[model samples]
Target: MNAPPEDDLSLGQPNVPATYFKDQRVTCEKDLYKSLPPLINGKAGYQSLLPDHTLVDTSNHADPNSEKGAKIRPDLGHYEHGVVSEEHPTMLDLIILAYEVKKARKEDIVNDTMKCTKPLPHDDCQAPYENTCQTSTITRGQLANYATQICRRQHRTHFYMVFIFHPFIRFIRWDRAGAIVTKRINYVEDCTPLVRFLYLFGRLDRAGKGFDPTVQPASQAEAEEAKKYLKRWEPKLERTVFKMDVPAANGKMRQFLVWGSLADPESPLGRTTRGYPAVEVIDGVVSAKPVFLKEQWRSVAVRPEVETLKELNEHGVLHVPTLLCGGDLPGQETKTHEISIGNWRVGHKRIDKRIHTRFVVAEVGQPLENFPSSKVMLGAIYNAFQGHDQAYNKCKIWHRDISGGNILILDNNKGLLSDWDLAREEADLDNGARAHERTGTWPFMSVGLLQQPNKQHTTRDDLESFFWVILYYGLHYLPHTHRDSLDHMMKEIFDQYDFAERDGMARGGNNKDALVRRGRYLGSRRSQQFSFIGCQPLTEFLFDCLDLLGKWDFRYDPTIQSWEEDGYIPASHAEMEPLWRQALQSPLWPVADRAVDQVRLSKRLDFIVRGERPERKGSKRSDPHDSIQDDEDDDDECSPRKRRKTCHGSEAAHL
Candidate 1:
């Protein structure tokens, strides 16, 4: 099938300097703080009229004579003593008052004054009025939020007794009365995975009261065998956790389910479902047997991946998960054969289990959903392209499916290209030109493939996909307009258009509505939108690629408005390698240099979207980290040009 017209392309001088990247360290703790908003001080702004109709400082009420304290003291008879009078006071009020005082002080110690008081106040003298905070019932959400805030500031040490006095203090009474509610956290829940992992391994608080002894190997021989075999084959194997119980034969074999990851020398497949790390009970002794668990898939697509992985491993590409072992299941064509005791499936399988494939590899690190920096994202793209180069040139294998989810970013700050189930040998392309079925993830698929009917897929299209990935990341990561009229049109085109429609003569295939259509056109249109007007560097970078790809083929001239007749010079990986490398080194959009952290980049981009200059010292270009500062000159109108062209139609139609 003939390819569709190329995207309108314009070549602009590269904006970012090559070889200017600088690395900066980032940790999970810093990222978490940046991502979530800090807790508000419970009493800082909490103000309401006292019983006597006087405004008081509920937050900073440390001194009795202070404005808020002066209001709170007269009721407790502290007007004379500056402390709770021994004569008369309600027990609940005293308890709550003491807690509030302690809260105002931000102290951890439970003052003795908060304990039970004697001689209840006479009915005539008692006010029986509740404090402002205690007048309402505190919901679990409020408590959790306040608790989280306290822990965030204090490093998870203390849980202040924030007594909300509205509607009366009834938490103690409600509990004593056996009222059922969502379980309350008495202390801040420590949910850090590493902390829990260490606790499981007896690395912290080794009391061994309820700890399972089977977490580690039972015998020294088993331990040595595990250490020796894993060291020789998968030296990166670090922490292992016992998962489940496995059925054994005649009570002779002790079987358990386990999963682990690479330790020192990191690998990409950090977390995966391979097989259980078990200590097999043999003839009265336990032995370690780390057998690979391979699943069965209907398509022979996995064969190429298995072969490619083996070849890559041999060449010392250890960042990618190295395959341990693989084989087809026996007895049922594609059905797995019974191997040993610790070889059962852990999770639920589909109705047709035969379509599934299970393979084992040296576990790498966990997958990261978000990137730390645009430089890091570019670094990942760079690494992926290098892998593609090696796979195509050295191994003669072409990865057909390159999507965001397939390429994993590991903890080692490295990107690992994976999930090659749709890959085919390069020889397949050389043999003959044939109409191949449409394949690839929708979001990052090549523009030519989207508009064109059945065509021979090539490595050039895959590289084009990498460009789309970069653009997609910037748009997705950088904040944009919330209620812009342009956004509505853009969303409508992406959400309502059909990307994979086929005509009756051309393969009469099933056509369905999709979230997006005309990938190249959509990208081009967005590049020109007012939302992207200020981000010319990034937009121009993408446009330049379209220009280059179009030029690679003699059939199309993106620079000219006219179409050319027949002769085709299909783009090759070798021809586009330099362009791709240049794009990687080029400067990104505002505040996108590696030196600027993700948090700052997000804020600056948000400001740019609002048609405002990025504020403060961080926006200055002098320091790469502080670059992209707002300029008085950049506060241009936020409307798109009147005749802006779009994917389905011009923006003027919507206007």
Candidate 2:
């Protein structure tokens, strides 16, 4: 059969002859370039540029498949003539447009020579890319950026080809709307010829049909099936209700709501959004080998918890939901793409960033907007703290961003520390100080991290964030008649914690007072919890936690008779554990004694509020000795001097 016209991009639609893809006598790399049809505009001459921006190859002489048109012609594609060259005089202009060209360092000759001496054992050279010799590959984001640069420079959509290797190519159509699609094509017998012709013609097959990159799951029925499968996997997921498509960091996302199980249906999980369950369906092409991707980091940080929680729950030491599920999305080809710039990797590429789509089922709980607390709050947060300690010390994963939303209170009054997206391995920490971007929720960040944004974050910072979480919620959410005072205190706290702005201006100015220590009242607010004074032990716990924060805030600059004056003792988990235990043991601590039915505790508190004597079975009064104290008489109970003497003495003894 006669070959389809060279300009026809739809060669695949017809029954292409087997001879069409038969190998011809290839002379040099230039012959391969020429054999391919002109892709940009109507003119020909395509060249592959190396990392150094040098023309690696541009010879265009067709042999057999593209033997008809073999001359090097001028490029009149979407990009203006000369825009394709790395040294195109407008290169600096491109960089200004944010198309950064990050060059990889040259390989070490001695090490590379030593490596190639013999056939490397499969185990020895398992990660050949890890060797110093490999040139750093660019990412799709980088391609998108460069395409954007071309578009901005020319004021029009530009069709660009990013060649990772001969058989691997990314077809990019960039414009004001962004990349139409970053299509990765792998060379195969029949398809290779068609891909070559399509690129040469500057048109993807079905060109008039607008390119839609938004991933539509093969079927909503299949997605629904996936949800049902997850519901079966974890019986806690009741039913998914609302779903909306959203942009994903790594893939297309479909965010859906599920009806989740209460932490403890029998016990009262205080202040929960019971009907709302968090479910996200991440759907995208599976685009890399599992071994060579940063998805492993997420696996390391998130997974193992399913089994770890099982083990911890069995032992009765740490308790949390076996919440995370969904491995690789099923029913997709395991295709691999080149390492590209995405959320995980920005400037440099170390490993492949796989685009994954899966159903992420997790517990959704109350937000901290106007959250109220009970005695169970103490125990719940304590257990949640223990959960963090377990994840850090036992699992070797640190929850870097522990803010209000990251934790949830279950129906049973159990607190679950969640949202491990910012969690990192202890090993990755050796890479040096963290960037300011990873400073978690700005309000919950530690003073040191807030003040010196580039400083290395430690577990101490996370602990401090947790401290702020408790204080912020406790101060703002406590049901007190002093609404005016609470509002003022809330404004004060928000001012101190809002690191992004100051007195109204962005903190971009070098204002020394903007530092956390200088801006806020540290120990002053503890005295303001007038209503909570009757809960003496709880008050003491709060003071002690604040004391630790105060010491940590000025850890380096010690006072004349400071806690660390005689011996420099930095805050550690060991010191905090006793405080958590003390908080748990408080009579006012919620869940000190849990009821199968949570309403009983509410009734007990209600009866106590009414100043009535208990009259019914199981109508228990909590801490009966404290009944006479009212908010009016509670001032003396919460006196800073008294709390300092008692709580400080206990903390010192523990130290």
Candidate 3:
């Protein structure tokens, strides 16, 4: 927690109020805020927010999976804390975008890594990229960390940042696409731009401040109704009691009193998804049945989740999450791409469009690990397989991202396939207008997909992913016979991902690929791979999976480009169906867990996405949370956490 006696930008009590600091010798960060004049509200047609002193502290809001917890603090933050807006019909607690500031010397912070010539060349900079500057690299990571924290707290289109390197100050705008940074402006020469920006920012309303206008604060009565449903929100997250208004063309508006989401993204970009426990409120009365509310920024290149769910539900697909209401947030497209930073070539190379989308489903359930017995686990997985097969064959919608996170267990112990946000329709895929894109959780992704970065998702891949999801669940919860270190064993067996230097793309599954192709479980220390204690049915079921699909020998033969080009088609859903069903009717039921551990199942999904073992005390490896590092790099460009910063962005010295 931050030590208080803090002053906010909107309203602060500075001891020495100085309007401009040009020639002043301000050495400390505290002095810079203590003496600077704030942008007091109602000054220029409504300059409400002011500048004050408060370190950008995010001690409480750690990634739930993180063991040591998130320990990050920027030099300063210009924010509105919490403002309740009564201007609209529904009282709204708008999603506020906080501006970050970092104190640094001229040598550390930069806009680009390469040196510019006197007369800029038409092609790339002739000088070698100054990529080895450690201070500059760490500063960029720090900025990313701050942006990630803010985005987790609120839904935003894009947010701004103030990067100061003493005499030189740079303005940066970050979004899902990437960051747009302005060239260095020597604040020592003139402070007008900085002052004008702060003053102008104060005059803007909630929407102008980058907060979602449609998300309003829930009234006292609505809050009470929500408490009856959800037990309690994440202690790390601020309890969000709010209303979501999804606009409809037929004059019918949708509203839900959302309590909290499943998990928050660790990074500022990508599909920042949250599964909310929500209840409908029509004509001021809360509905009896609670619903599952999903909010995410869908890539404009892909189809919307609402369309996929609606089509599947209409087609009578079984075991899929039932769709209720879903749509795109009106006029809520990402604005980072539209921004132009002259002379800075930051955000153009791969600027993918992202749209804010919301959808509601009638049913909600626990995750896969919540199952009490092996019987329930097998039954659930088999039924979920049924849903996947049905969707692929009947509705022609393939479940591309088949991870443990997407598998849900209903009140009746039946399995349901969730999170079709990444699903691709067969018709659309066959059309050939769209390019094949890689998607799925790393730990649970198919070996073939992981091995070949350019390969497209196939039903055979989904079947393998489903099997991996089951295996991952079993290893963590069920009793196992691997007598070695569990953490080390997991790290080696999962064979999650590691970045390749040539292209900066993630690669894994070499071990897993060898396992299936050669029929040997490859572990570094022990040859005795897996032996489930007291569960022969489960063990037999897993071993049988080796024979389910014939090996395609996806070895890269530099000669013929790719295996797909070599005319090798993936196995259909039907080919893997018989094995899944037979496992369900195994002679021995799925064994019940010997002892329930204290660890939660939801964090395990994070394990899959992070792709790194959860390092802790007594482990051979150094703990990751010891410093602020971006080990997260996704193959989809906007992949989940565990990356290296490689987006198309230029860096220049602020000085």
Candidate 4:
């Protein structure tokens, strides 16, 4: 992650300016003719065979009656008036006949014939029959033509020819019998290895069952409601799709050629249990639902946008993609032009009717297996944070879901943060709706996210989820067991890990010792360990991340008491300089290293507060909401035994 060597030829020079930090645009069509060389033509002429078996062009303008002219003529008196005659000829006739034969041989020479096979060397093989020997002595050009002729004779059966034009050229046979073209395309560019990995893993469309309108037929009332909602949201959705392209990794063709709609029962998106009838296209058109559910939450609480904004402000920081469009209404068209590669599917097969509503395509540079474990995979996670951080700061957007599935690794090995279905713009950190339901993958949910009235997701929660993702990559499993049932998982997370109490302990303040007790238990040596468990460094990193969440601290300006507090302190700014430098250097390393630094700084700040002179007068009054109070800790807690254990070692590992 260090700056690439200055003299590296492959990297060349950085083209983007420092001030214009945005997604880089790649010309999708540039890879079409990368490897083919120019065509060239050879000489055109004929040759004659002499009496000595040497071949030459024998033509002379001055020797009209001589042997050379006789060879070129069609008739002769001794050889039937310059036409070489085989019977009743004199010595002059014999010479003219031989010359004419040589001239006839010369007229038969071809310039571009392919030699199918070389004659066996005199020492390598027994002498062949005269006729066979003559046939074997063919040119390379003659050979090629002969082989092509043989192929046409034997294999000219029916088959469709597919021509793909791109990074590479390929001719494929579609139907061997019918001779119909099924698909012809050029090599794709801009696709990264991660995208290819996901494709090989399987297209997202195959994740679940086909749509069943018979089972979940829309009620008359619901259908009416949907129609009304669509009318209000359609224009905004169109504008969003037209404004930006979904970042994709496919480079073969700039525009996608979609054949159907997500709303169609037969379409990939409509067949999912939690399906959205929206279609998203990278470079072409996909017609379906306009907005999908913002989160996987079970209930409707606060507006989805409010939660999206809050998360972006706190967790996304700066790398959120602009929200082209989002909402619950169906039947609106949403399009994205940004090309990316990733898999998208909706619903768990076990619980809901499998609906394959989500679709994602990305450009991963090479095959997925070729990616070095730590460099490409882990690097992607790190870069996502950088981009997410940028978007949060610059565009005031937050990405509530920052999972492996949502992150796309581009062909250039850079991670692109995508899936803005749950993104939102924010003006301030503290001003947003309170969502009361849990959403996002269960394995990465923050401890607080598991509690009831699940609407309290924050940047800290996102950080905690990010920790889970890193753990997933390193350990290949969640830190704790998932419940047997989704309901159980939700309950365990919402009720057991009290965010408020853990927050106090994180700040180095006293709380119901239960919070610390839980942390020790989870991180303790006595806990059941799995084979995929990460090494100490990784575990320690996870612990540090948890500590940061407990402390509610951001890496930037750690002196700020709360995210809402706004002031630029020169001293705090100086302290942040090194952190920023570190971030720039390792743009793609997980935030673990930096998260640890933030935790350490938070602890130091707490120490300084405790060590301050009590006699100092007129210190600014601490905001009541910002103050950590030991008395306010909740005593109500859920028993761990009530939770069903779902982690069955590495069986659930996904790359």
Please report the candidate that would top lDDT against the real structure.
3
Candidate 3 C-alpha lDDT tens digits along 302-369: 78888988889999999998887778887787765555322344322335667888878887777665
lDDT-based ranking, best first? 3, 2, 1, 4
- Kindly list the per-residue Cα lDDT of model 4 for residues 398-505, writing each as its tens digit: 555556445545446566565444444454334644333234444444445443323444554555555556644443222223212223322333223333564322
Tell me the deviation in Å of residue 535 in model 3. 1.6
- Could you give the candidate ranking by TM-score, starting with the highest? 3, 2, 1, 4
Per-model RMSD to reference: 25.5, 20.9, 9.7, 32.0
Identify the runs in model 3 with alpha carbons over 4 angstroms from their true place: 1-19, 37-68, 79-103, 112-132, 232-238, 248-251, 340-348, 483-485, 522-529, 550-570, 590-655
Question: What C-alpha lDDT does candidate 3 achieve relative to the native structure?
Answer: 0.60
Candidate 4, after superposition: displacement of residue 176 in Å? 41
Give the range of the ten consecutive residues with the poorest summed lDDT in model 4: 35-44
Evaluation by lDDT, superior candidate among 1 and 4: 1
Q: What is the lDDT of candidate 2?
A: 0.37
Cα lDDT tens digits, model 2, 1-655, are 1234666644333333434324634444344444342322232233321111222222221112111111112111223244445333233122111211111123111112212222212223222322233342334333433442232222111233333223333343332212322333443234544435443433332122112232222345544544453342232212223332333336434444322222211100101111223344445222111100001111112233234443444554453444334333322211112322232211121222222223233343333321245456565667668888887676566667666655656546577665454555566676642323333554455666555545566878778777767665555444433333454554445334323343221121122123233433333334433434345566567667766655565543535356555553566777788988877666654422222222334446666788876546421111100100011112112111111011011001100
Query: How close is every model to the real structure, measured as TM-score?
Result: 0.40, 0.43, 0.78, 0.31
Off by over 4 Å in 1: 1-304, 315-320, 329-356, 363-368, 429-435, 479-540, 552-569, 583-655
Give the alpha carbon lDDT tens digit for every residue of 431-528 in model 1.
75222645454445565555453556777668866765665555554443322333343333222224324442112111111112223333434454
